[model samples]
Target: MFALLFSITIEAKEIEEVVVVGAYVAEDIAEPTEDNILETIQPTKTFMLGGFNGIQLSGTDTKHTGVFKNGVPVNDPSSGWYDFGHDLSTGQKVTVITGANSVRFGSGSMAGVVLLEDNFGRSLFTQIAEDETKAMVEYDYFQIAYYKGTQGSVKSTNTENDWYENKTFKAGYDIFNIELIDYYYEYDTCYDSNFAVSDDCSVEGEKLNVSIDHDRFTLGYTNNKSTHNTGYDMESDRTYADITLVDMLGHELGISGQKETYGERERETYSAYYIWSNDNVSVGYRYEEDEHIVRLGLENDGLRFSVGNSYRLPNLYEQFGDSWVSANPDLLPEQGYGAEIGNDWVSLYYYEFSEGIDFDMNSYSYVNTGSYISKGIRFQNEISLDKGSLFVYSEFTDSDKLRVPDYRTKVSYKYLGFNVEYLGEFDKGADFDGREIDDVNTFNISFSWYPDFATEIKIEVEDLLDNKYEFIPDYNSGGRRLKLSFNTIL
Candidate 1:
């Protein structure tokens, strides 16, 4: 095992983006406009169940993860979780960071951050400036798409059939740009509704983004609104602003603030980050109203080391919501510190591999007031020969129930545009309602075929081995189930 590890890490660069918990480039997982990129790329070992149809980071109970779009946090202010059902057809790329502690994202970043990027309008300006064709000079684009999905049922009463519609437009000139999107989704059966079966649930939403770029500075604004209707009703409205600057001395600065109103409550947040970079090292500081974070690191060639401290405030729902469990107004915010080491290696035979180890300690455990500690190690290896390539990834996490996974391994083979992958996990035990649930093995397999450069059809099966497990007692895992997706860009 050590020889295999050594051969893989020999060519690894220290400053390389750690695949397990660091920045991820969207193109590596799927094409732009693809759906569920998070579900496809990140190993399940990093996430646990979120109610029904939601995903939250492993090891943390409440939603401490922040989902940022174009540098602004977009997670539901009240619940602190990004709506997994939100349409992403308009997005350009996405980056997810898990178990990360940073000062730039203030309140709810104890678990991690997910950044969604969309710069279609800005790209159009560059295209017009570079293209000589008359047809390419206009900066206007519009798109419309529809998708449908179905899944078998666990309960005898209902099956899951879901579909959604999407439309978007981008238009603007050189110094300024605007983008708009309209989205809608409906469920055939009231399977996950908050009301009766007769009143099937549906959602309608709209988003608008405007930006101006000049010299070394940029300014932007975003507005989002959504409505959900069943027997009961719910609605949300969010507004946010961002500013960024790059100075002559190689310093980068950014600040963002937001206000979100949901149901009968409203809240606001503000955060900023600044960093100085030189040839071999970088230093940075971040501040949220509730927490302070700092980072100091040095990278020489491909080897890197860094240490940092992070703090997070309790979210609105955890402080006020009344549901299956009541809120605790006296709850204290969680704080922690962590460090990482990484290396990039390349084998003489051209096989490439990378490895990273991370250690984290928190002031309080999820859903409990006691201190908690966790350690994680991850590896990725790739070998290419002829027209085919083999990729392997594995991870191990030693932590408590909310975030415990003994081990996970994934392997994939790609050749001439066809790909197949398998993922499996050995999960630790969890407890609910004072009863301890048994540990279990989980398995999944996925296949993808790209008939051409612009089309993709995929099939994925979850829990292929039928190992029954639950994050919450009586809420058994979705057993062997099948899902299919057809995605394309015109």
Candidate 2:
């Protein structure tokens, strides 16, 4: 799974390297350091599709990926998919990890993990209590951003608008912390009325999240509900609690648990886990869905290796649903084991580069539609220059049925106050309905400008070439589209 860390401190440097995943990091806080995350998240990948930034590992569909907001799994319980459509205005840094699973996760992370963290709590209060030695009453962070997207093709029938806002209030008590996030989004599609179809189809949704931490323990909750004009609506709620402990040997220990309610059926499910870690070794065990998961890892200097086996519970739709022809409730949970080893390379224009390979064998992969063994090799490189910086990422995966890009790449350049980035993917065709589909190649480009340290305006264009091919049958590409967003701190 992926992890996101929000840092408010900016290293003292001249040419700060900037990287943007789902959230953007400026030069002020982009310099790498012993304690900074600049080097760890050097190469960032994000996709802007429809109304939100899609996951690179899941293609256009987000269900193939698992997402966690502040260590709590947020995928829809009924579908086990995350839209990634919510506004990240409350966050400062967003990280996505691929090809590895950590003790922090339970199920639904076969593809990878998406992490969203924020500094709204620390930055908002730490500033008011600026006196390094005292706590003050001044504390709060609020932001509002508007997003609009329009289809570029004249024949297009898609449009989107979103209004998002967040507020964080702290009392500077240091003993307790609470933060809340609220988001509302809506999108519309036009259908041919002549064919007895609804002229306009719209979907509206809202999400509310609350997190409270006291001392060494934290409790979090998320409620997400949505409605559709086509009579398909759903709601998912999740609650999680976790605590940290330190043993006599100075090793850290963590215990956490989660419970979720799926659909109106109200079927409840839960999971629990405990993990312990020292300087160079870590071990964890978790229980969920009548399955046991064990994880082991070791790290020394710049070399690291890890191996783990976990199971994914079948989503609500997979067990009992009328949308599909044959929804089987007896389907078994998907289980798999993964292993990886890598080393960081220093002393080059590329501050940090890592070459690693992993293998995952699944007994019953829900997304892949069956059992299969997949092997993947990952490569990451980043270069910092005087005027700008360059980052590169490539991965090769060998699998059957599941359609994943054979290779992908991203490029970024920052000069003066403007940033330009591009991401592209190359995927081989997968057989469907007794026919060999054509290979699909897609690319997206984004241009953003920072008027100041706290404000940014961005314009992004997806599917620049307007490729009409679809990864799945009947799922027509939305062609070329434009999205404009304005964000700032208040």
Best by lDDT: 1
TM-score of each: 0.67, 0.67
lDDT per residue, candidate 2, 279-365, as tens digits? 676676666767777766666776666666646666666665533223456666665565556654211000001111111233222
Model 1 lDDT per residue over 1-490, tens place:
2233223322211112222322212233323323344554454422221123344443443355566554445566555566654443333455655434244455345444666544332111100111111011122233332333322222224445434554555554443545566766654444334434542557777766665433433455656566666433444556666555544585768776767665676777777877666655666677777556776555576665555665655555556553323545666666666555555421010000011111112322224355655556666667896888988877666654353456667777887655666666665555433555445455656676779776566666656776655544443344565555555544
The Cα local distance difference test for each model comes to 0.49, 0.46
Give the runs in model 2 whose Cα sits over 4 Å from its true position.
Answer: 1-66, 88-91, 97-101, 107-111, 121-139, 152-199, 244-255, 267-272, 322-327, 345-368, 418-420, 431-490
- lDDT, candidate 1, equals 0.49
Q: Which runs of model 1 end up more than 4 angstroms from their true locations?
A: 1-29, 32-35, 45-62, 88-91, 97-102, 107-112, 119-140, 154-231, 253-255, 322-328, 345-368, 401-404, 434-490
